[model samples]
Target chain A: MIQDRLRTRMGWLHAWSGFVFGLLLVCIFASGTIAVFDTELTRWLQPEVPPSATALTDEALEETLPTIRKLLERDEKPFITLPSERDPILRVQYHDGHEFLNIPFDPGTGQELAARATVGGTFFYDLHYSLRNGDTGIIFVTFSGLMLLIVLGSGIIIHLKELIPDLLVLRPFSARLRAWLDVHVLASVPFLPFAFMMAYTGTFLHTRSILPPVSYLASINAAITPVAVRAESPALQKEKTVVPALPPLSPLLHDAEKVVRAGQVGFILFLPKNILISRTDASGPARTREHVDFSYDGHFIRHVLLTTPLTRTQQVMEGIHYVRWGGAGMRWLYFISGLATTIMIGSGLVLFLMKRRRLSGGRVIFRLAEGLTVSVLVGFPLACSGFFWGNRLLSGGSEQRTQEEVTVFFLIWAASAVWGMGGCLMKWRVQVWRSELGLLAVLSALLGPLDLLTRSGGTVFHTPTVFAAVDLIALCVAAVAFQIARRLA
Target chain B: MIVLCSVLWIVSLSVQAVSEPRMLRIARREAVAPALTVRLMRWVSLVGLLLCLYQRPSTALFVWLGSFSIATVVVALGWAWRYRGVQRVRRTGGGS
Candidate 1:
């Protein structure tokens, strides 16, 4: 009787909490999944930048100094990141007051490619962790992550007896409610380890941001300034006075890689009197604080690697979450797991409404919940595909072109929310899902053709694999969406 | 090695499914004790993990866990396909 009471209460908590936050969690997980290939997505977003496989040449590394020096002169914190497997082009990026502006360089020649500016892959990264709202978003997402643990715990407790017994059973052919519950279980139970790992690692990462120690007192200046300006770092300013000609980075990279591991030097941060060459995330599964420092003019300084137990544990956690060392296969694994996880949460949302549709189907609040469901499930995906569309169609000359691409994403999502809610207002829930899904299918199908039409011949010549792979994935998504849309009809 | 690990995981899960009485009944096969089969299945998976660890010690743990989830999903989908086929066979008055 006690266990029964516990299960009953836990069921209510699981159902309500899962539905409430699932609306946001689904989007977060979807975006996080996409972010697994953020580098590839960023490449596809800008068609002008050509991909290369060649290693960085010494001359090319030296050529970037002129640009770096110019940025340094203008009081900017410019840094150089080496080419990685997924992103073949070298990058010179700096904070441009609003965000980091990345300039792609040919690894062989250090010639800057005229890539179009957009948020690119980090858009999804930002969406995944922070919901694009900065610090406030981080705090909110952290709380939601804690709630996710609660929901998962309650759900497991409620279904403890059935978890292992029904582990391999997924009856898609069963009755409607049963099928959805089967899907929810199949998606959740098998991937419970991943769900827990992601939740804990992700939340732990942002724990530092939410902690009170950093801001023992609130910043009054934050309220006074309507527009936040980039503050010049005092260290960088002091370094600017010295302005000594630095040695070629290729040799330093060679030496750094010896300690950091070959082909693992991720980025080079320049200071007035020192240069810090940090190990790239792809170096290993542990994101260690390992770097090799040098004095002005290429004199070798000491190498740094943290070995404390607590720090090692943290580094491993960071590594697990980031998966910077992941290859194509691992990336796809992460992607599928993330999508499956999202589906678990999404199906729970569906089950919540399905369980209640008979009693509250016509209520205003119920209709609103149904609409929000469509917005999150159907609309968010449409907006994702729409982001690619906007990247291609929007003219490149406008200053607000980047913002316009972002606007396109938001506008489509908002419109989807409106369409879903408005249709549900008229009791057209089925019609709304079917129509919007069909639209998503059509748009996603068009992405490939649009890529063929819009992308430069140079980009195609440079990276045929990237162009084809991206288009093929879009086509696959379209095929799935079309089938689901057909089923709903 | 990771590929080998993934294949082993799927095979283990498939073994787990076939050893289940419900699955055997659906397939029209007689049930047997799964104790030995379960032990062998687990050993296969463990050796696969050992091979992965031997190959890439740092990534093996996460990769092992990652492959486990993915492989379980694959087995579940396979079971669904098998179950659906059996159901269709029954509806059409065919033998399981």
Candidate 2:
């Protein structure tokens, strides 16, 4: 009787909590899943740049620094991130608001590429962890992650008796609700380890912002800032002096890679007097979370490793969460696992409403929940497709072209929300779901064609298979949306 | 390699089915006595999967175990569907 009572209480918590926060979790999971390919998506977003052959050599690095130096403002923090497998172009970038205003350069030469200024894959990355609302978003996501952990625990308790059976048995032709539940179990069982890993690691990544003890009390206020904000370092700032010219980065890069045992020098952060080059990309799974430091004039400094057990554990957690060391195959595995998690959340949303709809079909609160469901499930994808279309169609010469692209995305998404809610109010729930999904299908189908038509000089010269692959993925999205729409109809 | 992994997965599930009568409606009485050996073979297949991937053991274990679970689920469902279909055909006395 006690066990039964515990299971019943857990089932209630699992269902009610999921219903309350399912939409937000779905968006977070979906965006995060997509972010596994953020590098590729960023490449796809800007199709005009020619493919880069290799990273900058010593002479090329020396030539590029002058232009990069000219672009730096007195207060601005300038960074040079070397190219990785997914993103071939070297970037001289800095944090703006939600996006990076980066100057892309030919890695082989010092020549700059005229890539259009737009938010690329970084948009999904921002949306995933923080929802681009800065600290509040991070806190909210962290809290939701906690909620997910609770839900996972409760769900497992409720299903513990049948966990193994659930893993092995999937009854597709069973009663409708049973079928959905079986699927939920199937998707959840094999991927439970991944889900728990992501939840804990994701929360840990933003622990400084969320936990009061690790950070100063004022950090709570600082979290409200719209940009990339961090707690001020306790170390005193160096005296203001004339900035010195940088030495050739090639030698530093070679030495840093050797010291850190990382394949590629992912990025170099230039401090007032020191340079910190982080090992962002590594060749294989044994990648270390080590960084190498150097004096301003290129003299080698000591290697910095996460030696403390706590910090090292955190580093390992982050490594598994981000998969920075993994090659393409590993990235694809992350992507697929992420997609499965997304689907799992999505089906849970469906089950939540399906159960509620049967009992209180026309109740005001139920209708509102149904409307929100339609908006989130379909509206976000519609907004993403609009962003891609706007990137291609919006004129490049406008002063606020980047902002305009973002504005277009939000406007379309807001419009879809309003339409979904209005349709629900007017008793057009089915119609709303069908139409929004259909529109998404059409928009997704057009992204590839739009890219093909708008290819400029560099895109025409060097054939980028990445662009083709991206377009193919968009077509696949369209096909999936169409299939869903047909099923709903 | 993907094919080899799939075959190993099938063997793992088949071993489970042979060892445990509850897993399937049709199991030979003699099959139940090989339970210990069959269980041991399942572990061997799992270890083989980890070796075949040739990656960090943690990552390979995560990737291949998840893959094996999915493949097992697929084969189990297929068996269920076939058994149901055969039952239906016998009941109707024809393939109509």
Candidate 3:
């Protein structure tokens, strides 16, 4: 009897919280999954970056010097990222207060790439954690993740007895409610370990919001630094700024390569009198914060490879969550897993509403809740595909084209919400919204052809690329959405 | 080797899946999988996973874990196809 009571109580918490947060969690999981290939998406969004990276010659590195100095003169700190497998272009990047705006340069020709500026895949990455709202968004996502863990736990307790037996049992032709329940269980139970790992690591990455660092603490009895020393540092910084000419980078990069593992120096951070070249995150599980430093005049200063156990643990956590250490194969695994988890959350939301429909179907509250479901589930993906449409359709010469693309995304999403709410007010059928919006996304039907036609069509056949996979995936999605819309109708 | 380990994971899970009576029906057998076949496959795949971990700890560990995800979906789809002919699994009630 006590066990039954506990299960009932947990079920109550599970239904309400799962429905509430699962709506948003679906968006987060989908965006995070796509963010797994953000760099590739960024490349797809920018077609003019050239098909291959030329050798990282000193001449190519030197060409970026003038541009870097110009950025420095504007008091913006700039860095140069070396060509790597994922992205084969030398880039001059600087933080433009909102996002890292970059100028791509062909590694071989030292000429600037005419790639159009779009938020790119980083849009999804930012949306995943912060909903693109910055710190407050991060806090919201972090807690939503925590609530997801709770929902998972409660769900386990509710189904503990049948969990193992039903772990792999998915009966798609079962009763309507049962079929949805089976999908929820199938998506969740079998992938519980992954769900748990991602939720924990994802939240851990942003724990500072919950427990702010020492900077949050009052400065009671804090030691004050000498004002003169503080003033001296900026004076020294100004001196370095004045002496902007840099030493030849090719030789320095060569020496730095020997210090880093596999001789893969991914990025070069320029200093007034020094340069810090760091190891690539793609090389290993522990992004060990390893680097080699050199003086501006080509003298080796130090090579630092952090090996402390605590740091290693942190690095592994980041590597696991980020999935940057492994090759393309591991990334696909994360992407598939993330998709399944999103399906699980989306299925659970459907189940929650279905289970309650018999009891509260007539209430305004239920109607609004249904609208929210449509907004997130059908709306977000609609907006995602629309962003691609905007990328191709929006004129290339438009000013602030990045923001324009993002605005297109939100507009489509808002339109979905408007239709959903309108349906709520007019008592229009759910199937109408589902099939209409679902078909209208065309499930991103033209994405592949759009990619082929707009981007230089040569690259598609010549290279195995992220854009190709995205195109193929969108086609699959189109087929699936057609079937779903057909069935609903 | 990690690829082999991933394939082995699917094979092992398939072996266990056949242990269920519902799954056995797909193989034209009324009997469940032999206890030994299921146990042996499980042990073999697990030990291979451990050895992979020992050799290339980071990649091995990640691949080993990731295998479960893909394997689950693959096995589930297999189940779906086998059960495709059946409709209304439960006539009047929800799933257990």
Candidate 4:
């Protein structure tokens, strides 16, 4: 009886929490899965980039010096990123008061490519954590993550005993409820570690931004002033004088590479006072916070390291969560795992609604909830495809093109949401599911051929095969959607 | 070599499952004498996993995790197809 009581209590907590926050969690996990391959997706989004035969060598860096100098003269804080194996273009970027101006160059000859302005993979990355809402989004996401942790804990407690015996038991031919329950358990168990780590580290990454510990402590301490109120660092106080005839960047980059012998230089930041070159390779879980610092005259200053062990450990955990060190294999794994998480959560949501639909008959609130489930599950993917379609079809010369692309995504999503709610109100739930899923399948299948037809064959074909890979994946997704739509009762 | 180890691991898991009373009694089969093969296979599986870890920890972990995920789906589908067809439940004595 006590065991039954405990199970019942935990079940209530798990079901309610999963139901309430499942959609948001799905969005977060889905975006995060895509964000794992953000750079590759960026490349895929912009197919106009010409192929680069040159590598990120000293000679190539030297070739790009004149343009880098020109950019530096124009912008107060211009930075250059050297191409690595994953990203094969040299990027010179600066903030132009409103947003960023990114100029992609051929790594070999340093010739600029006239790539269209598009919000590449960074959109997904920003969407993952912030939902593009800035600080409010981070706070909301962090709260959702915390809830996820709680839900996971309660779920484990509810099934702790059965977990081992039913570890791999998935009885798909059983009753509907039983089959869904089995699938939920099966999906949750294997990816439990990954889900837990991502939630924990993701929360940690946002903790300082929202509820900074130092400031929180200071608020309680009457005698102590907050760190935010502290005097400006000497680094920020450096005078900005016109740097005429600056030293060459290639030798400085060479020196920086020599200092950090293990990793490749990813970014070169030019400040009025100093230069910072950070490691670009995130091929491992544990990454050192090491970067080469240089004086304004290109003199080697110091190699910065994490001073505290605690801070180092935190950074390593953050690195593992962010996954900047991995190559293609690791990234694919992260992506797949993230997709699995979305599936797990999505299946759980479906199961909850299925189990409760009968009991919620004739209830408006339940119908609304059902509509929401359909909108989030089928609608988001629909909107995403719309975004990609806009990227291909929208004129690049238009002002605020990125914002327009984002607007297209939300418009489709909102329309889908309205359709779903309308259908549910009119008792067309099954039709809504079938039609939306069919639309998704068609959109996904067409995405590949659409890009192929629109892109400059000569340039895109010669470039990295990531374009083809994305298209192939879209086709696969289309196939999955068709299967699901066909199988749905 | 990694593929070999993964196969060994799966085989070992199957062997270990057969030793369970629920599984064996459902099959109406007696336990293997001394359970020697099961023990041996278990050790081999462990050793194989360890070898994977020693070589590439991250890859091994992901592969192992993915293996489990695939195994769950495959086993579930296989069981449903083989035994649950034309019936609501399998003959495992556990009602869903």
User: Which residue pairs of candidate 4 clash?
Assistant: A282-A324, A282-A325, A282-A326, A283-A325, A283-A326
Stretches off by above 4 angstroms in model 1 are A73-75, A96-99, A214-262, A271-274, A294-302, A457-463, B24-43, B85-96
Candidate 1 residue-wise lDDT, B1-96, digit = tens: 557777899988898888876667655678877777575875578987888788877667767877888888888888888778765576567753
What TM-score would candidate 1 get against the native?
0.89
How well is each residue in A1-489 modelled by candidate 2, as lDDT tens digits?
999999999989998897677788888988888788777777777777765467566665655686656644354467887777777777787766577667778878767878788777878888888888877888889888888888889989998987775565555544567667767777787678878888888987887766767456577666664333332334534344566777888888888878765455678877766788887744434345467889978898878866677876777777788876666666666776777677777778778888878789889888888888887888988898898899889997787887898899889989999999889988898899989999999999987768878876434345477777667777988998898788763
Count of residue pairs whose backbone atoms collide, per candidate = 1, 0, 0, 5
Descending-DockQ candidate ranking = 1, 3, 4, 2
lDDT of 2 by residue, B1-96 (tens): 444565777787767655655455322134347747667876656655666567455567556755665566566677557566544553466643
TM values, all candidates: 0.89, 0.86, 0.89, 0.85
Clashing pairs in 3: none
Candidate order by TM-score, decreasing, is 1, 3, 2, 4
- Candidate 2 chain A, which ten residues in sequence have the lowest lDDT sum? A225-234
Q: Write the per-residue lDDT of candidate 1 for residues A1-489, one digit (tens) a residue.
A: 999999999999999999999998998889899888887888889888865557778877888888888776776778898888788888887765444567788888878877788778878888888787766677778778888989999999999988886777777765678878988998999889889989888888877655645452453233233333423545334333536676888888888878877877888987666889998888777899589999868889999989999889899888888787867767777887898899999999999999999999989999999999999999999999999999998988888887898899999999999999999988999899999999999999998889978876734345477778888888988998898777763
Candidate 4 lDDT tens digits, B1-96: 345554665665565555655444433458775457556775556676677688777667655655555444455455445545434534344543
Q: A253-287 in candidate 3: lDDT tens per residue?
A: 88887777544787888765677888888877777
> Which of the CAPRI classes, incorrect, acceptable, medium or high, describes model 4?
acceptable
**Candidate 4: deviation at residue A447, Å?**
1.5
